[model samples]
Target: MSLRHAVLAALLSGEYSGYQLTKAFDVGVANFWYARPQQLYLELSKLESDGLISGREVVQQTRPNKRLFMVTDAGLAELARFAASVSKPSFIRDDLLVKVQAVDHVDVAPVIAQLDQRAAAAAAKVEILDKILRRFRGDLDEETYLRHGSPIGPYLTCLRGRLFEQEHHDWSVRAAALLRDRATRNGDPPPVSGQSR
Candidate 1:
């Protein structure tokens, strides 16, 4: 999906400045889509131009003037229409998976380190998502919420992101395990052997 659509979806929450939208995207929408602040800024300008969103300047004395955006009726109609359209599922575009596919011919240490990093990052993200889940649960029960939630997409996406991060952590743990096991199965690194590199 386009960042325009993502921005539009964000605007569905309420009016938000570009800065606020960036935070919303990072915290909520990053689960499904990734975009830089510049990209979001560009898209916001485009959406304004397209009449999908309306923006007003917010005066600030000490800081840069902010523009708060509210989704227009046309935007809402477009979103509803987009929702009615069938969407293809996202497929993986992971370099790590590609690396894993070719691990046999490569050194294991750096890759294991990289996976370790990914796992750590995922763990941190999962903690943040857990907090979101708590806030999500603060409202109605699951049945009622899912049926009539104000905006369930972010909550649902966080669930998916939580799972996705967990999978990364689990896979990294297993990959690291396999790498260490394989190393142990080898000639034992010559036991350090009092040898210099």
Candidate 2:
């Protein structure tokens, strides 16, 4: 999916200045999509020009004027069409995955370190998501909110992000452990197909 769609989805929450949108992307949308502030600013201009979104200048007492953006009817229609369309599967292009795959041929220390680092990052993301879920759910418990909350889309998306981060954390820890275990063996070949060669 394009950053355009992500921005549009964010505006579904309500109107936001470009600065606020950048912050929102950093905290929430970064889980599934990442875009720099510059990219967001540029996209906002494009969206406004395309008539997908409209911006209004806000006067401030001390600060310079900033434009707050809201989705236009065209934007909402576009988002609806996007939601109805079949999207291609998402794939990762991470360099760390490639390194992990080639661990047998390369040094293990760096790979282990990278895995540990990734695991920590994933854990951190899970914590962030948990906090966001709580804030979003407010007085309701997870089960109740999930079962009866209004506008459940964002919560559901956040749940998916949390689970994905958890999976990454679990996999990284396990991969690191297995690599360490293999390193301890004194030249014993790795077991293959239920037997050691």
Candidate 3:
């Protein structure tokens, strides 16, 4: 999906300034789509120019004025059109997978290190996503929230992110352990922690 559609979807939550949008993307949208602050700003400008979003300047006494943006009617219509269109299938395109594919030929030390690092990173993301999911549900229990929550899109997406990260962590840890065991059986030296080579 285009960044435009993502931005429009984000704006559906409410009006947000550029800074707020960046934070929202970081926490909410990063799971499925990643866009830098500069890229978001650029997309916001483009959306505004296209009449898909509208922006207004808000004056702040303690700080410089900022522009708050919201999706326009056109934007909602565009999103509807996008939703009706058939989506292309998603595919994995990770470099780490490529390395793992060549693990038989390449040195196992670096691959094991990378897998360990990936496991740690994925675990951290799982924690963050758990907190976010909790916050999204508030006092409502998960079943209750899923049954009767307003605006469940973000919550659902965050749930997907959590699942993805949890699986990633599990797989990474498993792969690393298996490789370490194989290396030991073959009398290869243990990988030095945090060493790239």
Score every model by TM-score.
0.88, 0.91, 0.95
Query: Residue 92 of candidate 1: its Cα lDDT?
Result: 91
lDDT of 1 by residue, 1-197 (tens): 67888889988888999989999989888988899999999999999999999999999999989899999998998888988989998799999887878778887666666677777788888888878877886767767767887568777878898899888777877776677677668843411111111
Candidate 1, residue 172: the lDDT equals 77
Give the TM-score comparing model 1 with the true structure, all chains together. Answer: 0.88
Clashing pairs in 2: none
Which candidate gets the maximum lDDT versus the true structure?
3
Tell me the lDDT of candidate 3. Answer: 0.91
lDDT of every predicted structure (CA atoms): 0.81, 0.88, 0.91
Q: Which has the higher TM-score value, candidate number 1 or candidate number 3?
A: 3
- List pairs with backbone clashes in candidate 1: none
User: What's the true lDDT of residue 79 in model 3?
Assistant: 99
Best by TM-score: 3
Instruction: Mark the 10 consecutive residues where model 1 has the least summed lDDT.
Output: 188-197
- Greater-lDDT candidate between 1 and 3: 3
